[model samples]
Target: MTTTSGNTNPASVQLSAQAFRDVIGRFASGVTVITTCSGGRNFGTTASAVTSLTDDPPMLLICLNKSSTSAHAIRESGTFAVNVLAEDHVQLAGRFASKLPDKFEGMAFEKDGNGSPLLVGAIAHLVCSVSEQVEAGTHYVFLARVEDAVAYPGHPLAYFRGAFGRMQMAPDASVLREVRERIITTVNEVDQAIDLDRWAAELAVGVDLVHRALIALVSEGLVRREAGQFVIAPVPESIIFESYTAKLAIELGVAESTVGRVSQGQLTQLRQYMEATFEFIKDDRFTDPEAWIQANERFHEYMVELAGSKILLDTYRRLGLPGLNARTINRSTYATAELLNDHRKLVEAYENKDLGAVVEVLREHADRPRQLRARERELFGRA
Candidate 1:
């Protein structure tokens, strides 16, 4: 498991190429297609071993297999362009990764300042002139000084464990929902400015995905853009009061619309959520507010789902009630016993098929967040 002077130690366990590849595959990498032009011919290959070597003069390096046409073209032409692929470039990545005679046969690409082909729709394009080329084992590491670069805001194509993929948040509804939930939860937990890049790195998602989620939050009034940065929108007392007022109206309407219509399956799901919430409460596990918030949301979401009104549920979501609830709970110093009791009453009313009791409990539940208005105002301080 050790190497000395480029040689594996005799006593250490050595790994085959496939074993090394498998182990390194756990380190996810962004996919890029390295393109170079030589003698009026285009050559390209999918690459992942690209890195930013320096930032002062802006330089990068890409390691290419010595036998690849791109490596030969870059060495001959002294220029290459690194086109960082987007999530939608899976087919293009496959084409370049193949041994196709002319990878750019039917492909459309624009030449960079260095006469290197830059693929369209790439998240970034870096045109470079090869400054140094060192042969390492079976590959040539080309150290290039970036002549020009352009970046587009988009999710990146990713490679992991021998498969081409994209970051999980974009285009996946369930993943996006979870991302959105986590973002809101984080915002609730912190009073400082939200950093999209930091959150993306921590969540193992693309910054573009965080930006998209923030934009969705903006539409819901949970986040606001200021100075080109996303921040949690301040929740004033009046807004909190107004939010609960609206929730009371909506949930009462939902209760009337569903009542006896809720199925045993839906009831069973709601009961499961209740059990989870009570278990967390019984164990006094409030250290992770995000978990409690998610459990609470699930309980309410099941109630909304029982109503079977997509329009109503969508409208409620658009109001950003989840974010509002998080803000309320996190800011308040009050005990959650009352809130837990309200939930128990809500479930009981639903089980008994009592429309009046359901409406009453929903009203009480809606009113609870309003009690946190003073604390929210103190924390957020005037809008």
Candidate 2:
């Protein structure tokens, strides 16, 4: 049989038609009603090929068979809307799927604030004005701008090949248990004969266990690993990705987590680490900024680790110490003195065990750098 990864040739997989359907049905997709209007006529089609591409000025894409009548209308009109279907709209979905004479004969819908027509009970609707179109094989893919949108509280209708489906959230306890099990499995799966470096040594677990655990963690939507380490997935990159607010938020989070946890001994170790870091930067002796950057990251790691949330710590590690971006440090623009001052505030916050104040300071600590860098960037014209 052909594996899911498509590693084996399709011809090698021998299966009856029914069996083929069963196997191909494993992949899941969100059901959507794609709508387009042109020449004063509106048309709708059921599709599963809609997906979001970005949030900044929000964008989404929908692919359609070029031969589909609706595809021609969308191309002519230069606009369309992807209405994410609700579970109860299976009949509506079917109606759109067919090339019936008048699919919207009895359908109830209203023109949205944008010119797009919206199905009344859709879970979510994205009214898009086409930005670009690309032809891929027989499909004309339209990337569009989210001009407007609306949503109603309902379960999303999902599809896997031929059948409809829905997403169900697992209980937290069960999820945690599953994650632990996967981690255990990964720790044991790594081949011992393969001499792993120090970083890999920290991952002393079975290969499958590690793989499954990471997958589970990612799938759970609680954590994310941006590069080498893991950290909390940001709620919205709208503020984080393109703004200075993002950097500050990251720092504040790390600081708060660090200050909220750890013993006096741990604090002392942290203090020593910070002082050593400050001294190294002051000496101007280190030629390789990466080494300094690593040490700088380790200091923050101590704080994040002390926060006692493995998930948070993992996320911080993943974000790779936002304050130490290579460009920021390499250009000699890093605020080492400011960081040391922040460290003192973090130590005080830790000693006082004031969670509220810790969070407050952390937030400010994070925002300050981002705000300044933004201004700097504005002045310097994209540094």
The number of residue pairs in model 2 that clash at the backbone is 22
Residue range 249-348, candidate 1, lDDT tens digits: 8788888988887888887888889867764443322445657778877887778777788898887775566675566554223435667888888888
Candidate number achieving the greatest lDDT relative to the actual structure:
1
Using TM-score as the measure, which candidate wins?
Answer: 1
Stretch of 10 with least lDDT, candidate 2: 187-196
TM-score versus the correct structure, for each prediction:
0.47, 0.42
lDDT of 2 by residue, 213-271 (tens): 44455564434655555443422323233334543465566655555456789878877
Q: Report the Cα RMSD per candidate.
A: 18.6, 22.0
- The residue-level lDDT of candidate 1 at 9 comes to 66
lDDT of 2 at 155: 85
